[model samples]
Target chain A: MSTRGQLLLLWTTPVAGVLFLAAYLMFPGFSPPMSPTMTPEEVAAFLQANLTATRGVVIFVNLIGASLVPFFACIAVQMLRVGNSSPVFAYSYIICVGIGLTAFILADYCWGVAAYRPDRDPQLVSLLNDMAWFFFIAPAGLVVVQNLCLAGSIYLDARPKPVFPRWVAHFNVATAVLMIPGAFAILHKAGPLAWDGSLSFSLRLATFAVYVAVMFFVLLRVVQQPVESEGVLL
Target chain B: MAITTADAEPLPDTNGNTTAPGLVPGEASMWFFILGDLLIFGVYFVCYMVYRGEHAGLFLQSQRHLDQGIGMSNTVVLLTSSLFVALGTEAARAGKAARATRLVGIAFACGAVFPILKLVEWLPKLGAGITPGENLFFMFYYLMTGLHLVHVLLGLVILGFVLRSLRSASTPNMKFIETGGIYWHMVDLLWLLLFALFYLIR
Candidate 1:
């Protein structure tokens, strides 16, 4: 593949990230996430109040996973250069991306169902909303495993000139560790472990954003260098 | 990868005492991990303190339920384990692979006691229906300690690798041994902070 083409794929990550955040902000109750403790009637009312914008956000949110595919593929492209004799890590990276993207797609559809009929029973709508947020935040394990695979591949790269810097591997592990608090979101309704809480929501989001930025910049360096003799397999 | 002379060479300090030249005592990459891990945990500590300040009474009440005895016991266990690791690293440096292997084996044995004690501390409370959902304090307690436990478990695995290298390699990877020691010590240090915050703080 042309380096120019790979760079284009790399750019999709930030584009998708920014668009997702924009869609999130377009929805009224999501910036400060809707509290898990919010009553069913309150959740239903909030959805009813912003019904049209909610649908718009849902549509954009659903498209995010598709837009992010190119970026993930690009990551795997770089993983191909990690010098492991077997291409298992690159394959593992793609598998993880599929799982992670499926989670977001499922989460988006939950929101869509919640807004499908604003006049639906408040309890059901609230349940779907709960499902949406749970699907959104609680699947930190997916990202954790994904990054660990990437980090492991980089760490095991025997080449003196590794595709990704050694510190990036450490950074990836640290990012994975930070995401773990989100796994416990299922156990709390309030405080820092809830879907709406600081450690689970804010910290994870920040870490993820920073992770994307770091990966983007590093991948940029990868694509800019003259194509090595060991070309990308894909 | 073999240890480089730059990492193995001894140098004199300002006081003229010769010391190992690897000032950071491991791969620089491992130090990066240690610092990043510390920063992440530091954030959690700050968050815990803020929440504790908001609900001092509830936190105080919840904290009293924690078993100080087990907490202190685990602290001693980890400290002893860390001491062995330090001695093990020194022995590895002095070219005593067999002795180093023994010391690290002892460290692993001591480190293994930590999870057992954690289960002992946790099982009764869980049986009594206390869980992360009981209150914010318990939530932080379980979450932080659980995270720390993972570190301990991972440290044990690293120590295992260190032992394997010591036993099998013709020239032991001193840098690898030192890196494992650094990680084990960090695990020990985090547990001490956890013990103080969860058990001793009033």
Candidate 2:
């Protein structure tokens, strides 16, 4: 692909990130997240009270899966240049992103369904809400794998001029480590490890936001350099 | 590029005597990882303190349940392991490959005791039905220490690689060795803070 084309794809990262963040603020129960300890009636009541905003989020949520594709494509393009051998890391990264995107879409769909008929049985509404949150927060393994694959590729890049800097690899590893606490969300219904808690939700969200911005700048720098050497094609 | 034993060069001395002054010990990237890891953990520490202040009685009572004897023993074990790793790094820099390998081997043995002790400390409490869901204190204890255990496990893997490098390569990769050592030390440092926060803060 042309460098201009790649640059355009790379630009999608920030565009999607900012748009998502802006859309996120438009909703109430989502940004702060509903408490996991809420009773079924409270959960149903929450959706009914904020039906319009919850419904509005579904539109952005549907677009999220597709909007981030170009950004992930850009990441794979960079990964393809790292190792001399077959581009397994880039392949694995693409696969992980695919699964990760599905997870996010699934979570949103659960929310969409929950918001669809808030007048329904409270228990059922709560069930969908719980599933949505679990899907949203607990599938952090996918992101962790993506980061590890990218970091591994960067570390194995023995080129005199590596694709990404070494510190980026370390940063990726750090991000992965931070994401691990999300796994604990399932084990806690309250406190900092719950789905709505500080460690699980706030920390993961912030880390991902920072990670995207950092990678966007790094990709911008890479795309600026003329594509001269051949390593692997995406 | 594949490195052969014959082509391996002597390792660089990390000791101040041979190296220039004001040099950081390991790959700059590894130091970045160390600092970033510590910053992430620092967030948890601050949050823990806040929660403790809010629920001082609960936290203090939970703190008593922790086995201080085992905690103290693990501390000594890790400290001793770290000392050997330091000496091993120095030996490797001095090009004493066999001696360096032996010292690191001892360090690995000491590091191995940590997880065993952890299991010993955890199983009884767990069997008694004390889990993360018991309370906020237990949740932080399990989550933070569990995260630290993962770090410890990864450190052992890195140490294993360092041992392989020292044994197999004629000229070891000093940067790799130093990086591993730095990570091991960070793990040690984290445990000290955890010990203070969870076991002795009352």
Candidate 3:
């Protein structure tokens, strides 16, 4: 791809972020997240009240959020450029993140399914909602591995000029570490570790948005550089 | 201090300081890490305080369950290790490679005790069924401390590399040593706040 074309692909990273935020804003009643402590009746009523809107917004989330896959794939390719002859780190990052994003898309669809039929049993709707949120936020390790692979590759680049700056590697490592708390969401009902709690869901989401923004800029700089004979830009 | 060759030697220019050029130790990238890490931890700390304020009673009750003895001892261990790391960085800058190696080795040894002490602190809690799932306070305790533990482990790895670079290279890689030193110090500084917040604060 031409530099301009590659740069445009990177812009999809932030577009995904914006779309997720939009989806979040579309939540019914702006309900303070469906805590596990919330009763099934409450969840069922929520679904019944906003069934159509929920389905539509979730579909948007699934389609638009999936943009992250292509964005990260672009990152993996950039990593490959600077990763010397061995593509282990870059490819591992790509595969793990690919699976993780796929999980997210699947989880969003589960929410859509829950909203599809307002006549379903309240308990079943609640179950589906729980499953969707849990699946969306609970797989912290997938993110950790993806970030670790990217960070490790940057640290190991050994090029005269690294593909990404060393600080970017440290940032990824820190961000990866920050994400571990999200896994604990499974253990709580209403507290900060709950599936939709601040530390687990909100903080992780915020950090991820910030990370995507930073990497977009960093990758922009990389792609704009002249491509070398072997396709390494830096 | 007496004027010696060590004092007269020009410091390695790492941070772009001209007057006392090379005074700022470590790769500039490390500063970025330090600042960003501090900001991230700051956010976590703020969240912790807010939650603790919301459930003051639960937090206080859970705070009593924490073993202050182990917490204090761990603080001491890390502080002492950080001391050694700082001294090692100075020694490396002064061109005392052997001394720097020895000090960092000590730092690594002290740093190594942290995870073991954490296990010592954690096993009994787990045995007593006080896992992170116990309550919000314990959850923060484990989550915050657990994250710090990961940093400690990574710092130990960096220290090992520092030791290797110090010993193997004809001249010590000052940038590598300083980077590791600053990072280890950051680990220590973070624990201080964690200790105050989780263990000592009333």
What DockQ does predicted model 2 obtain? Answer: 0.01
Candidate 1 backbone collisions, by pair: none
Candidate 3, pairs of clashing residues = none
Q: Kindly report which residue stretches of model 3 are placed more than 4 angstroms away from their true locations once superposed.
A: A29-31, A232-234, B1-202
| Candidate 3 local lDDT, A1-234, one digit each (tens) | 356667777887777777777888886623567777878898889788888778888877866867777678778878876756577888788778877877787778778888888678988888888888777874477889989988888888878887788898899999998898888887788778887688887888778878888888888888776664344322
Candidate 1 segments whose C-alpha is farther than 4 A from its true place: B1-202
Pick the lDDT winner: 2
lDDT of 2 by residue, A66-151 (tens): 68788878888778778546678999999998888888888889989999999999999999988888788745878899999999
In candidate 1, what are the lDDT values of residues A1-234, reduced to their tens digit? 358788878887888888867976897667768899999999999999888989998887776657868877888878877878777888988988888778778888998998998789999999999888877874588889888989999999987788888998999899999999988888999999988899988899889888888888888987776654444554
For model 3, the docking class works out as incorrect
List, residue by residue over B37-115, the lDDT tens digit for candidate 2.
9999999999999999999999999999999999999899999999999999999999999999999999999999999
lDDT of 1 by residue, B125-153 (tens): 99999999999999999999999999999
Local distance difference test scores for all models: 0.86, 0.88, 0.84
Model 2 misplaced regions, further than 4 Å? A228-231, B1-202
Better model by lDDT: candidate 2 vs candidate 3? 2
The TM-score measured for candidate 1 stands at 0.52
Q: Write down the C-alpha DockQ for each prediction.
A: 0.01, 0.01, 0.01
